[model samples]
Target: MTDQHAPVVVAARRTWIGTVGRGHHERTETDLAAAVLAATACDLRGLGNDTPTDDVVLGSCTGPGGNVARAAALAAGLGVGVPGLTVDRQCGSGLAAVIAAAQQVRAGDARLVLAGGTESASRAPQRAHRAPHGLTPYARAAFTPAPWADPDMGAAADALARRRGITRERQDAYAVRSHTLARAAHAAGRFGPESVPVGDRLDRDERARRLDPDVVGRLRAAFTPDGTVTAATASPVSDGAAVVAVVPESVRRDLRVPGLRVVATASVGCDPALPGWGPVPATRAVLDRAGWSVADLRAVEIVEAFAAQVLAMTDALGLDPLGGDERVCADGGALALGHPWGATGAVSVVRLFSRLVRAGAPAGARGLATAAVGGGTGVAALVEVVR
Candidate 1:
């Protein structure tokens, strides 16, 4: 918990993100996670720190009930000595798992931990709720109680966009920017080094295409007739996994590699009606704890579940939403990359590691990763590049 024993991320890696029913339809969550875990472990060994992993913690949203973390750990060949834990906090699952691992390391209970998230939307099994009379089928479980408002994510995003006065033009512009940057990043080979190929495809994404702004303007609203949210503005049903190896600063120094030192973390609750607002309070909390403001951040990454949702968060945080804030999602976000639910939170961190550490940013340059959960929650972590 102190400065000496602070947790740091020594290595990060992720599987190739694919569309739900297209590229990753045959691969399950366990498969995707195992691939990334093995890749991260290889990274550790490459750094000459092959200490056995103390735990394997993963987050999942739609996985079948059994301990999928343990299954994934075994699938990754972590052996029986390591235990596993699975966390489900809606979309914030991956970040929550990472923070949990960090806390364990801070407490001196774990020397090394591998943590991240996975999602297999295509492989999500059908479910039937058992009622008194018979069985009732449902698409997805509710995020709020029956008495509270729990609209579908798209509908809620559309409603929030309308309520917050975020017009269609702004939303479409953001979406186009995301696609353009993501495509450019991939073309420049910025993503290849961080990717762990899982299937036939190697270091390629199926969703990152530049959307014509003219065409984006003509598309109809998907949630409401007058709403601004559209297919292009929302993240797709995706499948992928991402993990980071967490250790104390001492271990990182011995490995002779720079890392992102955990400065502070915050997880907070907000109104369920507009879940996009979750990140606002969470980000503020971390900034407050770290005694830094938005202007001090060198880079920032937020899970782009929806264009309108992320815009709302950025707008509230006093960051320019259009293009002035290059530090925020410079390479793009889930909009173009695909939102694999539980895996999205971890993906944000990996992107930060790329933007900061991999890019040779000076030591102490701070970066942040934050996410908005579906069930009225936000999770965020503040880290700085450590030499």
Candidate 2:
């Protein structure tokens, strides 16, 4: 019953994620994006000769502020004939780029497309706007007109934890588990196939993998006085890139490439004051559209913006947040691996591809990748392994 013309992911890859200003400091966002895009293109070609890519779409939050997608395509040697586009939907940018490409393929605009996201936090430009009459500069952008209501991420996380009865101890425990799982997955070489070396060094996510419960507990609150939310529970600023090749299912069959059918995508808006809750409704929307329930998913990846937020989401979905199910980010998540802003969502897709496609899961095994965006936006995508 699989639709041969459905959009499918045939290849997926990502640069080794790095902490902000450390691992990929020497490289530009374009450099990171080009590396992943080129690797994906080469992989697609290796699979077959007729897989012509029509466009490249990339999501970026704060780069050099130009059309980074175009720059990356040219840098990847994909030729000027391939058009490019860049999107900025905060944390959802990466997944949104993939969705946009998938829609184009579904509309029969193109047979193949490259889509994903990249972010070089270290190189992100320092932005400022001139005041009236060229007075003082504004250093930050406002997410809402009511400044008092728009809480910083940490404040929102702390509030969510308090309202949801998620204790500081529980958050710390979840962080520890994330690190533990990530280290174990890395030791098992789980990241080898999907990870690409970045810059002049071998690829590795050299973030906070080692965890000491006592140390994490002792860390002071990062955003609010007497708050439970700390740096340990929040996603770190990071740099990286990820890309997936989207082709029709028929093309996948012709090339003998394993297919991960993108069955449905959903995006929704929530209260800008509490952005973390965005994922709940978005995931619900997608599942409803696909006529599937959360329990039906074989694997799931939710951006780890904060442990408290993730805990809330798990409760909403009626799942155990720290149970360490193989279906939920088996290789760890943003808490341990670091969050590369725009690239995090696409990284989730790359993880799904690895879990269901590269690992040869049984046909029809379903997966989900969802994220809560900065401006109270949530995006989710559902995919199924196709034979």
lDDT of each: 0.90, 0.88
Judged by whole-model lDDT over C-alpha atoms, candidate 1 comes out at 0.90
- Compare the candidates by TM-score and give the number of the best one: 1
The CA lDDT at 29 in model 2 is 89
Instruction: Summarize candidate 2's per-residue lDDT along 1-387 as a digit string, tens digits.
Output: 567779999899999988887888888889999999999998877886476779999999888788999999999999989989999888889999999999998888889899999999988877766677765555446766765467777888888788888899989988888888889988988898999897666457878578889999999998889788899999999999999999887788888767789999999998777788889999999999999998899999999989988888888898785775567777889999999888999999999999999888998899999998876878999999987
Tell me model 2's lDDT, rounded to 2 decimals.
0.88
Error of 1 at 148 (Å): 1.6
Clashes of each: 0, 0
Taking the tens digit of each residue's C-alpha lDDT, what string does model 1 give over 1-387? 337689999899988889989888888899999999999998899999967899999999998888888999999999998899999988899999899999998999998999999999989888889999999999888899978889888988998798788888999999998999999999999998789999785458779996988999999989878788999999999999999999998788888899999889999998898888899999999999999999999999999999998889888888885967898899899999999998889998899899999999999899999998886889999999998
RMSD of 1: 1.3
TM-score, each model? 0.98, 0.97
